[model samples]
Structure formats: structure tokens, C-alpha cells
Target: MMLSEKYLQIRKHSEQICEPLEREDYVVQPIVDVSPPKWHLGHTTWFFETFILEAFLPGYQVYNPAYNYVFNSYYETIGNRVIRTDRGNLSRPGVKEIYQYRAYVDAAMLDLLKAPISPKAEELLLLGFHHEQQHQELLLTDIKYILGHNPLFPVYSTTAFKLHHDQTKEREMISIKAGIYEIGYSGTDFCFDNELGRHKVYLPEFSISSNLVTNAEYLEFINSGGYKNFTYWHAEGWDWININQISSPMYWHLIDGVWHTYTLAGLQPLAVQEALTHISYYEAYAYASWAKLRLPTEFEWEVAAKSFDWGQRWEWTESAYLPYPGFSKAAGAIGEYNGKFMVNQKVLRGASLATPEMHSRITYRNFFHPQLRWQFTGIRLAK
Candidate 1:
């Protein structure tokens, strides 16, 4: 597809997510798990305008110069952004004005996409397309998090990501012998900067589960008083649990003492075969240890994932997210993608249903804090 067409579709997907939401729902926040919908809409526009249009388009006009401050997310290279805590207070721009801001930029972006001449410009446009998809996932996640806080427990859509029955079964355990394995994405189409610089790392011999740990399996963990007992948790995990007084994953709640998960589609009985998602890396690790298993190293995960449903869910790994050997970043603000975050985070392989089909790949390394479980995070086991 031409870059313009692709961007149109990409931008549309971001809007499509809002079809089920009302203006009143735009600013909801149950917890820290979500950004306001208005924020997401405005932020993605800031991405293209701040990063691409303002840099390359001659005489490009910003809809509201103040938005440059208000919506500029975290790119410090680009002046100042409106403070995050105040995102909920921007009732002046409201929802309609934000859409107008998006529409104005969408027109300018299409103009620039057509006027672009250099291969570098084209590549960056593709990067923006993927960047928008990332936000589309965030849009759903943030809304779910916000709705989760509300007593009504609103449902966004009924489309299911998993089957009604638990079709996932335990297959023969595959043992990978100790050796060095190549890790990271090597393809050339487009990737987050973090997935570059393919490198090798040593992995110990280990047995990994055939499929993700299912909701049914996790129910066993909960029924066994998994949250009540700190013995199965790491010290940090214990602290996180206590500090937050966390009983389960972010959206999980008890109804008549039975576990039900809240989502964009309201509350439902947890799908038994679907991977048990929204657990932190600390929780994933603790749960693995409880099962007498360990989280797979990223290298081990990259290698084993090549043979399974690597696109289904974000698979947690034991390794902290770090720069690869011989890794170097691109020059300038575009470099903001990944070079800075090469510390104190665990890598999750694969992608979730929320991820655009285009961006999902085996070697894509998504990282988050060990104690964060709100994204579409889940677990696979290593023994």
C-alpha cells in the first residue's frame, strides 16, 4: 500500500476504537493503568506533528501552538509538554476540539506523505504508522483500566480474543539443550529500534511449556491462596503486593468469591484456555517459581518462540531489557524510540491481539516494569 493509504487506515483504526466510547468516557481513569482517551488521540497526533511534519514540512502549521506543550508526551528533545497529572484537567480542548486537531494534522500528514521525496522520509512515515498502532493498543488498555475503576464496569466490545472452551492442552515438553542462541529481529521492513542488532547469548538447558499458562491454571493459583501467602513471592513482589495491597491482576475482582476479569466488554467468566494475562513480570516469575519453574531468558524465549504461536501474547522472560552487543542508535530525535530505556525492565516477546497484525513479530521485544501487569501481558513457563 502507498504510505498515505496505510496512514489513513492506521489513523482510522485509532478512531474506530472510540466508536464504542462516549465523551463522558474519554477522561475516565480508574487507576494508573490508562491515559485519557483525549490524551491518546492528542498524543498520537503530536507524534506525527512533532516528529515528522514540523521537521520536514515547509510552513507546516500547528492547530494550537499550546498543544505542542499539552500533547508532547515524553520527547524531551521537543521542548516542554503539558504535565501528565494535568491531562485530565484539559476540559477546554475537550473531545471535539481534539478530533479537529487530529483532522487538521491528518490533512497535513497526507500532504506531506505525497510530497515526501527521500527514502529516509518514507521510512519515518512507516515508523509513524506503526507508532499509531501502538497507541491503538494503548487506547483499549487505557479505557479498560479506566472502566475497571468505575463501579458500572463498562464493556467496550464483545469481540473475543480467545475461544469459549479451553482448547489449549499440555503437549510434550520440549527441552532445549544448553547453547548460544541468536536473539532479536533481523528483518528489514521496519522494527522498533530495540529489536535491531541481532546478537547471541548463552542459554542453559531447559524445558519450556508447550502453551501459555491458561486462566484455568491460574485459577488454581488463586484458589491455593496464592495472593494470601507471600512465601511464593520475591521480596520485591511481596512489597509491591503489600504497598498496593494487590489481590490479583489489575482488573480482576471477586464476585461472590469467584474470579471474574473486567475488560472493555464488561465482566465475564475468565476464559479457561486463554493465556492468563495482565500479570506483572514479578508475578509471572513468582508464579513460575511456585510451579517449580523459571522464567525463560530472552535468548531462550527468542529461540523457542520461533517454533510456536509467537504472535498470540506477550511472553514474559527472565532477562532484563538491555542493549544488545554492538548496538548503536540512529542520529537525532528519532533515536528517542529505544536507546534510553535499556535498563531495569524485563522483555516480553510476541504481541497481543491489541497489537496491530503488522507490528506483531517473533523477535519484537516489549518491556515494562516487573510490577506492571496492565498491558496484555501473560506467561509461558520454563523448567
Candidate 2:
């Protein structure tokens, strides 16, 4: 496929995910990490304008100059912008305006892709698509978060990603032999900068669960007072639990002795056999402790991933989000992407159902703050 076609397809899918959303759903940011769906649309457009069209195309005009302040995320090298917590408060660039912004930028991007470009410009263009794909996943997740937390329990779309009950496979652990292994992306294909600089690491032999922790399994933890018992939680996790009064996973509700949670398909009975998702690192870690198991490090996960089925959920790892030994950031605003966020985050491996096709690879490292539970985060036991 041509580069222009790939770019259009990806950009179109981002819009499709929002098709089911009501006009009002596009402007909400329920938490600090989640950008409003409208913001995602605008910011992704801004990324192309800022990085590709404006940088690569001669005489490219930005659709809106003030949009820089509204859409600029944490890239301090770019310019000053809105702090995250106030995203929901911005109402000027309504949903309609954001869509126009997307159209405007999309035209310029396609025009740029029509002509041959330098290798470095092409690299940035590919990075822009992947970056949008990352936000596409975030778009779905943030949409879920916006709706799931509502008192109405509004369903975003019945067709959105959800699990069907599967009782055919028995849960088992896959044992991996200890060995030194190469980790990180080595291919010429597009990968985020963090995934570059492939290196070697030694992993002790460990057994990883063949399947993710199930809803029924997590139910056991809840019934056993998992949230109440400080022994099962880390010190900071314990504080988080107490302070937030969290008794179950983010969307869970116990209604008249029945377990149900809000989903893209709406509030429904929790599927016991389905993998438990929408969990945080703290919850995953605490549940691991409760089960007397451990979460695999990212390296260990890559080493054993082929032996079992994954990609249903973003499995949290027991690793911190850090760079490889020889990793270095590029010299400009693009350089600020992943390297800056290395400090205070936990890594998740595998891909979620919302993850776009070709967007994830085994070596891809996804990181989030420990307290966030809005994404499709799950656990795979290792010991």
C-alpha cells in the first residue's frame, strides 16, 4: 500500500471510533491522563501539522494558530499549553471545530505524502501515524472512561470492543527456561523511539500464566477481602485504596449480590470466564500478591509471549518504564516524546482489543501511571 493510503486509513479509523459517540461525549475529560475525545481529534491533527506538514511541506499554513495552545500536550519544547487537569474545561473549540481541524490537517498531510520526501521526513511521517494510532487506543479508552463513570452508565457503542464468554480453554501456566535473550525492536519497520536500541538481558526461568486473570479469579480476591487487607497491597497502593475507597476494579459494582460492570456494550453481568480488565498496576500487583504470584518483567514477557495467546488486553509488567542502555533522544521536539516520560511510570506489554492493527509488537513498551485504571489493563502471572 502507498504511504498516503495508509495515512488516510489510519486517520479515518480514528473518526470511525467516534462515530457512535454523541456530540456531547467528545468534550469530556474525567481524569487527568485522559484527553477529551475532541482533544484527541484536534491534537492528533496538530501533530501532523506541527511535525509533518509544517516541518516538511514548504509554505504550509496552520489551520488555527491559537490551536497550538489548546492542543499541545506535554511537549515543553513546542510551546506552553493547557495543563492536563483543565482539558475538560475548555469549551471554545467545540466538537464541530475539532472535526474541521482534522479535515484541514488531513488534506495537507495527504498532499505531502504524494511527493517523495527525505528519509528523515518519511520517518517522522510514519511516527505521526503510529502516534495517532496510540491516541486511537487512548480515544477508545478515554471514551470508555467518560461514559463508564457516568451515573447514567451510558454505553458508548454496542459494537465497541467487548469479550464473549469462552469456556473452551483451561487456564494453565507456561513455563519458560532461563536464558539470556535479545530484547527490543531490531527491525527496519516503524517503531517508537523507545523501542529502538535493541539490547540483551538475562532472565531467570519463570512460569507465566497461559491466560490472563479472569473475572471469576478477581472475584475471589474481592470476596476474600483483597482490598481491605493491607498485607496484599504495597504501601502506596494501600494508601490509594483507602483514600479512594476503592473496593473493586474501576467500573465494577456489586448490585444485590450480583457483579456487574459498565462496558462499551453497556452495564452487563460480569463474564466470569472473561479476562479481568480495566485494572491498575496497583490492583494488578495487589492481586498478584493475593494470589502468591508475580507479574513478569517486560523482557520475560517478550521471551515467553509466543508460547501463549495475548493481545486481548494490555498486560501490566513488573517493570518500570525506562530506556534501554544505549538509548538516546533525538535533538528536537520529537525527541521529547517517550524519553521524558521514563521517570514515574510502570510498563505494560501486549496489546489491548482497542489497539489498532500493526500498531503493537512484542517489543512495544506501554507505560502508565500506577493509579490509572481506565485503560484495558490486565495481569499475567509470573513466578
Candidate 3:
């Protein structure tokens, strides 16, 4: 497909994800990490404007100059911006106005793409499309969180029933002998900067589960008093358990002894054979310990990934989110993308059901605070 067609398709998909949301659904921010569905719509549009239109399209009129202040996220180099937590507070732009802003920016983007593109312009444009795809995943997850926590427990879409279907793949462990191996993305296609500077790493012999931990398996952990036992949890994790009083995965409820969880399809019976999802790093770590196994390091995961199926859920790995060897940041605002986030975050390899097909690759490194369980996160055990 041509670059222009690809750009339009990606942009359309982002909007398609938001189609199920009600106007109210687009405005709520239940947690700091989860932006409003509408905010996601606008912020992605802001990215193309701030990076591509302003950078390359000379005489490109800014679509509401104030949006830069309202939508700019975490780019300290780009001048003063809204605090991350305040994204939900902006009520003036309204949902309809944001849609207008998106249409306005997308038209300019398509017109620019029609002409011969410079290497720099093409690079940023591709990055913008990839960036939108990241938010497409976020849009679904955030919408889930917004509805899941509501008193009404609203359904985002009926199609979410597809996620509850059981997987028939037999469970097995794939063993890898200890050895040095090449890791990280080396392909010529577009990849994030974090996947760059491919390098070699040594690993001890290990075995990894063929499938993600299922709801039935996690239920066993719960039935065995996994939450009650402190030994299964990290020091901080134990503290979190006591403070938050978490007994089950997020959105789960024990209604008269039946296990049910809120999904995009609304409340439904938990599928026991389906992969356990919406779990935190702390939970993943604790479950591995309970099973007398461990989470794979990012390098170990990369080496064995081809041998098993993934992309069902983002599997937590036993690795910090630091840059690979010889990694460097780009000079300006874009530099803030991945380099600065290396601290205090756990690495998750593989993609989730909500992840856009083009946005994820084998070397893609996803990170979040260990306690965050909002994304489509699950466990894959290693030993």
C-alpha cells in the first residue's frame, strides 16, 4: 500500500476503536495512566500536528494553538504543557470539537502526503502513525477501565465477547539450552528506538510455558490462598495488597460464588481456559514464585519467542526497562520518547489483544509501573 493509504487507514482505525464509546465515556479519567477516550483521540492528532505539520508543512495553520497546551503530553522540551493528571479536567474543547480538530489535521496530513516526501518528513510521519496505533490499544483499555468501574458497569461493545472464547492449544514447556544469542530488532522495517543497537546476551538454560497462564490456572492460585500468603509477594507488593485490599484481578467480582469479570462486552462469566489478563507485574511475579518458577528476562524471552505463540497478552518479563547497549536518545522533544522512561518500570514482551498489528514486534519493549494492571497483562512462567 502507498504511504498515504497506510496513514489514512491507521488514522481511521483509531477512530473506529472509539466508535463504541458514548459521549460520557470519552471524558472520564478513572486513573492517571488511563486517558479519556476523547483525550486519546485528540492527543494522537496533536502528535501529528506538533511533529509533522509544524515541523515539515511550512505555513501549516495550527488547529487551535491552545491545543498544544491542552494536549501536549510529557514533552518537557516542547515548552510548558498540561500536567498528566489534569487531562480529564479540560471540558471546554468538548467531544465534538475534538472530532473537528482531528478532521482538520488529518486533511492537512493527507494533502502533504500527496507530494514528494523528504526522508525526515517520512520518518516522522511513520512515527506518528505508529504512535496513533499505540493509543488505539490504550483507547480500548482505558474505555474498559472507565466502564468497568462505573456503577452501571456499561458495555463498550458487543464484540468483546470474542475475547472470551477459549483457546484449544495444548499447554507445554519449551526448553532452551544455556547459550549466548543475538537479541533485539535487526530488520530493515520501522522499529522504535528502544529496539535499536542489537546486541548479544548470555542466558542460563530455561523452560517457558507454551501458553499464557489461563483464568482457570489463576483461579487455582486464588483458591490456594495465593493472596493470603505474604511469602508469595514482594515486600512492596505485600504492602500494596494490604493497602488496596485486592483479592482478585481488576474488574472481577464474586457474585454468589460465581467468577465474573467486566469486559468490553459488559459483565460476563469468566472464561476459565482463556488467558488470565489485567494482572500486574507484582501479581505475575508472585504467581511465578508460587508455581516454583520465574518470569523470563527480556533476553531469554527474545531467544525463545519464535518457538511459542505470543501477542495474546503482554507477558511480563523479569527485566528493567533500560535501554539496550549503545543506546542513545534523539536530540529534541522526540528524544523524550523512550530513553527517559528506563527507570522504575518493568518490561513486558509480546503484544496484547488490544495491541495494533503494526505497532508490535518481537523486540518491542513495553513498560509500566509494577502495580499497574489496567492493560491486557498476563503471566508466562519460566524456570
Candidate 4:
């Protein structure tokens, strides 16, 4: 696809995800981790304007000078902006204004793409495409969180969104022979800087499940008092469980002695056979402990990924979110993307149903603070 076409398609999809939402829904940030839908739309637009149009397109006027303060997210080098927790507090720009901002920047971006561009501009354009795609996934998940938390338990869409369910596949462990393995991105395609720095690592023989853990399987742990048992949890995880009174996965409810889960399609009976999701790294680790197994490290996951079906959920790995042997940050604001976030997070391999088309690769290293359960996260066992 042409660069301009790809840009338009991705930009459009972000809006389509919000079609079912009410104006009120676009302004909420329910938690510090979940940015309001309006913020995502504007932030993504600001990325193109700041990085591409401002840098590459001469004579282009920024849509709003104040928008940079409103939309800039976590690029310390980009100057001061709104702190994350306060995103929902602003109501001035509003949803309609944000949409207009998107349209304004989209025009300039397409115009820039029409002409022959330098390699640096092309690189930032691709980065913008993928960056928006990343927020596209977040847009859906954040929408889910916004609606799912409401007392109404409203349905975002009946048919517009659906998660992949893995149930019929028989559970089995796929054995991987122990050997030294090359890990990290080795392809010519676009990948985040974190996936760079290809290196080798030695691994002992191990076995990983061919399928993800299912709702029914997880129920066994919960019924056995998995959440109540600190033996299965790490010290910090145990502390988190007690401090937050966390009992089940996010969006899960036990009603009238039966389990139900909130989905984009609305609240529905828990499908025991479906692959479990919305789990945290802590929950994954505890569940693996209860099952007398362990989660795969990211390297083990990459080496064994081809042997099994993945991408149903973001599978939690035992690996910490660390840089590779030769990892280095790119200079400037772009460099701040992944390198700064290497600490106190766990790596999640594979992709989730919420992930955008062509957005994920096996070498993709997704990290989140271990306690977050808002995303479509799951687990696969290794031993």
C-alpha cells in the first residue's frame, strides 16, 4: 500500500472504534493507566504534526499551539505537558474539537506523503503509523475499560469487535530442545527500537504449552483459593492483592453463584473453554505456581512461538523488560520511546486479539507494570 493510503486507513480506524461511544465516553480516563478516548485521538494527531509536518512540511501551520501542551505524552524533551492522571479533567477541547484536529493534521500528513520524502521523514512517518496503531489497540481496550466499569455494563458494539477464543485445541506441551538461540528482531520490516539489538542467548531444553490457559482451567485455581494463597504469589503481588482487594480478573463478576465477564459485546456468561484474558503478570505468575508450572521467558517464547498458535492474547513471559546485550537508545524524543521504560515491567510476548492488523511480530516485546490487568493479557505454561 502507498504510504498515504496506509496513513489514511489507520487514521480512520481509530475513529471507527469510537463510533458507538457517546460524547461522554470520549472524555473519561477511569484510571491513571487508561487515557481518555479523546486524548488518544489528539495525541496520535499531535505525533504526526510535531514529528512529520512540523519537521518535514514547510509552510505548514500547527492546528493549535496549545494542543502541544494538551496532547504531548511523556516526551520530556518535548517540553511540559499535561500529566497522565489529569487527562480526564480537561473538557475544553472536547471531542468535536479533537476530531477537527485529527482532520487538520491528516491533510497535512497526506500532503507530505505525496512528495518524495527524505529517509528520515519516511522513518518518522512509519513510526507515526505504528504509533497510531499502538494507540488503536489502546483505544479499544480503554473503551472497554470505560464501559465495562460502568454500572450499566454497556456494550461498546455487538458486532464491530470480537476477541479470538481458543478452546477446542487440545492442551499439550510442545518440547523445545536446549540450545543457544538468536533472540530479537532480525527482519527488514519496521520494528520498535526495543526489538533491535539482535543477540544470542543459551537456553536449556524446555516445554511450553501449545495453547493458552483457559477460563475453566483458571477457575480451578480460583476455587482452590488461588487469590487467597500467598504461597503462589510474589511478595509484592501478595501485597497488591490485599491492598486492592483483587479477587478475579478485570471485568469478571460472580453473579448468583455463576461467573460472568464483561466483553465489548456486553456482559455475558463466562465461557469456560475460552482462553482466559485480562490477567496480570502477578496473576499469571501465581496461576503458574498453582499449576506447578512456570511462564516462558521471552527468548523461550520466540524460539518456540512458531510451534504453537499465539496472538489470541498477550502471553505473559517470565522475562523482565530489559534491553538486549547491545541495546542503545536513538537520540531525541523518539529515543525516549522504549529505552526509558525498561525497569519494573514484565515482558509479554505474542499479541492479543485487540492488537491491530500487521501490528505485531514474534520479536515484539510488550511490557507493562506487572499489576495492570486492563489489557487483554493471558498466560501459557512452561516447565
- Which has the better TM-score: candidate 1, or candidate 4? 4
Give the Å error, residue 363, model 1.
1.3
Tens-digit lDDT track of model 4 for 1-383: 99999999999999999899999999999899999999999999999999989998999999999999999999999999999999999997988989999999998888888888999999998999999999999999999999999999998888887785957978789999989999999988899999999999999999999989999999999999999989999999999999999999988999999999999999999999999999999999999999999999999999999999989899999999999988999999999999999999999999899898999999999999999989999999999
How do the residues 1-383 of candidate 2 rate in per-residue lDDT, one tens digit apiece? 98989889999999999999998888888778788999999888999999888889999999989989999998989999999999899997988888888888888888887888889888988888899999999998888888888899987777655544343488788988888899999898888889888888888878998888889999999999999899989899999999998999988988998999888888998888888998989999999999999999999999999998889889999999999988999998988999999988999999988898999899889999999888888989999
Question: Candidate 3: where are CA atoms >4 Å away?
Answer: none
lDDT of 1: 0.79
Runs in model 1 deviating more than 4 A are: 160-167
lDDT of each: 0.79, 0.89, 0.89, 0.93
lDDT comparing candidate 4 with the true structure: 0.93
lDDT of 4 at 195: 93
Q: Model 4 residue 153 lDDT?
A: 95
| Ten-residue region with minimum lDDT total, candidate 3 | 159-168
lDDT (10s digit) by residue, model 3, range 173-244: 999999989988899889999999899888989999888899999999999999999999999999998899
Model 1 CA lDDT for position 189 = 78
Report the lDDT tens digits of candidate 1 across residue range 1-383.
87788888989888888888878989765455467898899999988887788878899987888888888777777788777777777776889998998999999988887764577777787788888888888887787777777788877778733312233655556788889878777777788888888887777788877788878778788778887788888899989988988877767787896778786678886666777788998788778877887888777877887566656568889888988877787787777778888888888887886777687877788888888887888888887
Off by over 4 Å in 4: none
- Worst lDDT run of 10 residues, candidate 2, spans 159-168
Could you say which candidate leads in lDDT?
Answer: 4
The candidate, 2 or 3, that scores higher on TM-score is 3
Clashes of each: 3, 0, 0, 1
Error of 3 at 32 (Å): 0.8
